[model samples]
Target: MSKLRLVHCLLFFTAICILLPPIAARGGHSDYIHPGDGNSSFHGIARHLFAQEEPRPSLELTRGYMTNDDLEKAMKDFTKRCSKISRLYSIGKSVNGFPLWVIEISDRPGEIEAEPAFKYIGNVHGDEPVGRELLLRLANWICDNYKKDPLAQMIVENVHLHILPSLNPDGFSVRKRNNANNVDLNRDFPDQFFPMNEDLALRQPETRAIMTWLRNTRFTASATLHGGALVANFPWDGTEDRRKYYYGCPDDETFRFLARIYSKSHRNMSLSQEFKEGITNGASWYPIYGGMQDWNYIHGGCFELTLEISDNKWPRAAELPTIWDYNRKSMLNLVASLVKTGVHGRIFSLDQGKPLPGLVVVQGINYTVKAHQAYVDYHRLLAPGQKYEVTASSPGYKPRTTSIYLGDNAVTADFILIPEASSRGKLLRSNCDCSCKNCGQPLLAQFFPETNNGITLTLVVVVVFLCFLLQRRVRYNLWKQKQSSRRSITV
Candidate 1:
């Protein structure tokens, strides 16, 4: 081939290679894999040239692992065992028709109230089963320690916690990352920057189930579990350029604070030598399109984190208890952070004293928290020990903003908006009480009670209009006089 032709061919091949998914997330997650043969992929050969930084310990996948049927049975038993504070329900079914079970833990299990609700989604990737296992253990632990443990009692009575242990049970059964149809659930949501996942029909059943769940329920904040790296990941998960860089969402500080809480609470997550605080912005680490983390924050109004709890995605079943113990504090602190911090309140209309479904936003933060449709209530999560200017807005009504020092306690930041059209109506209502008999009485009668019938309102209005016209005519005459004087030719 000629040199020019060879150059063109080489450039095309390079573009294709760059676009292909990684064999596995380098030392992180392996979300993408070779479809035909998993062994077609391999870790970087450089590990052979240089000693591997971290040795891979022997992992026995089936030793203590629960099968799909066993997990379902465990969930069913938990509901029966702790029927008062927990209820077992299915959000939707997976592609294989396996019911996507959820265990809701609250004092009033399914009743809707003013309290905030949180959700924990696990096993997004079929291969990462640790999250699913840990979640079931969390539910059982809470049940075992309900009022006996302070934190457990607080979560049960104050917050509505929903736990979906396995979203991709079919994938878990097959021991792969993708679901039965081979669509990666993490990359299957509707993206704001791209249209690849926008077509609803193209979405997987698991993705549709999550989308429908968010629509029916309002979650204050949530977290999804994954494995590969040990760090707390926050949004915006993807960047506009699709390049690797630190791209923070509007609520960067708040997300960082939240991530720090989880890491610090964990046994040794905060001691990580790779990540600074054992927390990273998703885009900073790597950019993935159609990620659930960004979609939850954008569409569902839920502050979500992608947590990589273990270096090995599938650790030995014997290590499961140790892993759960390491993550227990982080999980509890994250859920407790919902009720322990931030500002929450309902928006109201000034005229009718009714609720207004307005938006709550922090001044410097670009994110918006939406009020619930039923009660017009909003829950905004922010880091404590800071002064923030919070604003609330709605259509056709004036937006209201206020500054408050949000301490450790949850501050009630309610707003009352005045509709734009109400000004004229209020003025008219003030002028006359809409009484026919009072039509002839001047509005000034309120100032002078004895002149109640002295000057008819109609006569007063005519006199005022006549004075306005006369004043305008006098001004015109003065202008004509000045113009004529200035235009007159010198004699």
Candidate 2:
């Protein structure tokens, strides 16, 4: 053969050598001997490298636990049984289309009140079914004893308590740690430091439902139940640098106080040997990204804690009763803490005595607690035995600050904001009657004579039209002056 032909053949052989191994590997197992055939070391190494997750636990393991349908029935039954104080609602559906049911327990359920709100979420992880069971118990216990038990009665009357029994019903059915889409719901929320999970379209249904639910309801404090650990975990869940260290949010001390309420009230959570005082800061223990605990605090203005109630991820169904017994007081106390320890108040306008829907902020803390729009009520949770300078402010009004020595009980600190001088003049103009101030006649009635009934009606229409033009002219002048001022500043 010629030299060029020989060279071409050599290049083709080299290309075949480079690609043949992978092609043959994909073609058939006959090309390669199985590591499991004889060599124990190769078999072990291969198995370890490509190991799959453990099989989903059989339904037999969840025999005594309530299924998704059973939970829905139980929630509906509880609402029917205690219709006077409870309401059953669905926030949204899961990946598998299971309704995310929530039971609201309050004296005036479904009605917005000045009272603070609290929420408890169970079964964030599908395999950690303990919280879901315990939450049902919590609801029934309140329904059965609210008439006699003061704690239960207090929760029913003073606070709007929302309990979500299962956030990951799809995962719970399959006994997996993630939702039906295999996305970990806890880690699917938008992160603070990272832009990951910012696209709402890409978010999991479970996380989106939670984000939407929080937008509708204003919760002062909340907790989610999980297993495989026993402690109260609080934000900041993840650090900015992604390092494992103690990172706390703006209300770190207040969060610690809230977490301790659950830890100390528990039968033996505070006695844990692993976690100090059975309360661990999330980042201190281990930093995790996109956790719901931090997102609630940062975005929704809700203080949320991740409560690991059981050491075993999936304890026997027979042990659930004991687990509930251990956590019942803790859960109740945590809910009661919203009413017992916070600095609660309403913000009003001094001129009109109307609700201002203002903001309540403490002097030293960086966080701002917003008052409700309807009631203008604000619930600020703080550590007891501390003096705080609480300030309430609103647009077009002067802010008012008050200092209070909060004791063991909640303190009411209502604020009445005074309008600014310019704002007061505008308010006066807006509320002024469309009549002559000096003479007791309509402002523009003088322009027309009082002749017949037809002329009188015509005069009224003309006066109203003139007043509308005057108001529009006044607003346009203000806008013009504002634009002029901006131009001067830019120049």
Q: Enumerate clash totals for all models, in the order shown.
A: 0, 0
lDDT of 2 by residue, 100-213 (tens): 999999989999988889999999878889999999999999999998998898888788999999999998888887788766677678778655556677678889999999
What range of 10 consecutive residues in model 1 has the weakest lDDT sum? 482-491
Angstrom error of the Cα, residue 128, model 2: value is 0.5
Off by over 4 Å in 1: 1-60, 419-491
Query: Which TM-score value belongs to model 1?
Result: 0.77
Index of the highest-lDDT prediction: 2
**Poorest 10 consecutive residues by lDDT, candidate 2:** 23-32
Error of 2 at 82 (Å): 0.6
Task: State how far residue 146 of model 2 sits from its true place (Å).
Answer: 0.6
